[model samples]
Target: MLHPEDVPTLREREHGRNLEGCCGPHGGTGPNLACPCGSLVATLLADCLGPWEVRLHPLRTWAHDPTGA
Candidate 1:
């Protein structure tokens, strides 16, 4: 799990693969041991991290997205 501060609370879709920071034992601050976004984590945690957050499909939603993505 990521330390509350470093977590973006949401992720954007990268089509097939979206590897952001690492959600490994050391978290995003350490070496990236695994991909932290998409179906991988969703299968493990039962919730797709990408779709759970604000989606970039809408331009009006950008400001509320907080990701600046």
Candidate 2:
């Protein structure tokens, strides 16, 4: 049985596999594991050694809001 908290919220549609699998089988995206972002947020949180926070900055505007126009 898998724990609900042991899963990564970020998911990739293009990749046939989930983020959890990339980290390692049954590893549940640990901080020590290599994530798509190349960070170890998962492992730190899982081990309860420290808190993890990720901030995403929008680099570019690909689309415009049609409703605003």
Give the 10-residue window scoring lowest on summed lDDT in candidate 2.
53-62
Candidate 1, residue 65: Cα displacement in angstroms equals 23
TM-score between model 1 and native: 0.16
Q: State the lDDT of candidate 2 residue by residue for 7-58, as single tens digits.
A: 4653332342323442333334432333455433333222233233322223
For TM-score, the strongest prediction is: 2
Off by over 4 Å in 1: 1-16, 24-52, 59-69
lDDT of each: 0.29, 0.34
- Model 2 earns a TM-score of 0.19
The residue pairs that clash in candidate 2, if any, are 30-42, 30-43, 31-40, 31-42, 31-43
**lDDT of each residue in 1-69, candidate 1, tens digit only:** 333234354432344233343441212222222224442221112133322222222322223456866
